[model samples]
Target: MGIISEFKEFAVKGNVVDLAVGVIIGGAFGTIVKSLVSDIIMPPIGYLAGGIDFSDLFYDPTGGDYASLDAAREAGAPAIAYGLFINNLISFLIVAWAVFLLVKGMNSLTKKAESEAPADAPVEPPKEILLLEEIRDVLKAKA
Candidate 1:
C-alpha cells in the first residue's frame, strides 16, 4: 500500500478518533481544574491561612528586598516560586481524583451491563444419543 493510504487508514481508525477527542476534552478539563483551583478553592484556603496569597510566596536566593513577586522579577532577582508549585499540585490532585471517580463509575456501569446480559442457550443432545433413544423406543414397542 502507498504511504498516503496507510496514513489515511491509521487516521480514520476508531481508536485514533477516540484518542483525539479524549485529548481535546482532557485539555479543556485541565483548564477548568486550573480555574477552579485558582479562583474558588485557593481563595478560601488562603484566607484560612492568614489571608496569604500563595502565588506570591517565593524565596529570593540573592537576598534582594522586594515588595512583591512581580517587583522581584522586575528587579531581576532569582527566586523559587514554591507557591505556584503548591497551586499546581492541588490542581493536579483534583484532576486525578475526578478521573478516578469517573473510571470507578464507568467500571461499575460495565459490570452491571455485563451482569444484565442474557446467557447463551444450552447445547442440544448429540446425534448418537438421539439415535440410541429411537432404537430403544423401537425395541420396547416390539417387546
Candidate 2:
C-alpha cells in the first residue's frame, strides 16, 4: 500500500483519534490551570505574604542596580526567577491533584458499572448426559 493510504489508516484508528482528542483537551486544561494558578490562587497567597509579587521574585547574580525583573532583563543581566518557578510548581501540584481526583472518581464509577451489569447465562449439559439421566431414573423406578 501507498504511504498516504497507510497514514490515512493509522490516523483513522480509534486509539489515534482518542489520543488526538486527549492532547487537545489536555492543552486546554493546562491553559485553565495556568490561569487558575496565576490569577485566582496566587493573588490571595501573595496578599497574605505582604503584597509580594510572585512573578517579580528574582535574583540578580551580577548585583545590577536594576529596579525590577524587567529592568534587569532589559539591561541584559543574568537573573534567576525563583518566584515564577514557585508559581509553576504550585500549578503542577494543583493539576496533579485535580487529575488524581478525576481518576479516582472514574475508577469508582467503572467499578459500580461493572457490579451492576447482568451476569452471563449458565451453560446447559450435553444431550448424552440428559439421555443417560432419563435412563437412570427409569431403571430406579422399576427397581
Candidate 3:
C-alpha cells in the first residue's frame, strides 16, 4: 500500500483516535486543575496561612533579602523555590484524587452493568428425553 493510505489507516484506527481524544481531554483537565488550584483553592489556603503567597516562598542560599522569589531571581540569587514546588505538589494530589474517584465510579458502573446482564441461556433436554418424545410421536402417528 502507498504511504498516504498507510498513514490514513493509522490515523483512523480506533486506538489512535482514542489516544488523541484522551490527550486532548487530559490537557483540558490539567488546565482546569491548574486553575482550580491557583484561583480557587490556593487563595483560601494562602489567606489562612496569613496571606503567604506560595510562589513567593523561597530560600535564598546567599541569605540575601528579597521581596519575593521573583525579586531574588531578578537579583541573580539562586533561591530554592519550595513554595512553587508545594503548589505543584498540591495540584498533582488533586489531579490524582480526581482521577481516582473517576476510575472508581466507572468501575462501579461497569460492575453494576455486568451484574444486571443475565447469562441464563435455555438448556436443551437430555438425548434420552428427545428419543422418548420421538418414539411417542411415532406411536401417535401410527394410531
Task: Highest TM-score: give the candidate number.
Answer: 1
* Model 1 stretches astray by more than 4 angstroms: 122-143
Alpha carbon lDDT of each predicted model:
0.94, 0.92, 0.92
Ranked candidates, highest TM-score first = 1, 2, 3
Q: How far in Å is the alpha carbon of 142 misplaced in model 1? A: 25
- Indicate which candidate wins on lDDT: 1
Instruction: Please write out the lDDT profile of model 1 over residues 16-61, one tens digit for every residue.
Output: 9999999999999999999999999998999999998988899999
lDDT tens string, model 3, 59-80? 9989999998888998999999
lDDT of 1: 0.94
Candidate ranking (lDDT, best to worst): 1, 2, 3
**What would you estimate as the lDDT of candidate 3?**
0.92
**Model 1: clashing residue pairs?**
none
Better structure of 1 and 3 per TM-score: 1
lDDT of 1 at 94: 98
Q: Write down the worst ten-residue block by lDDT for model 3.
A: 114-123
Task: Per model, state how many residue pairs clash.
Answer: 0, 0, 0
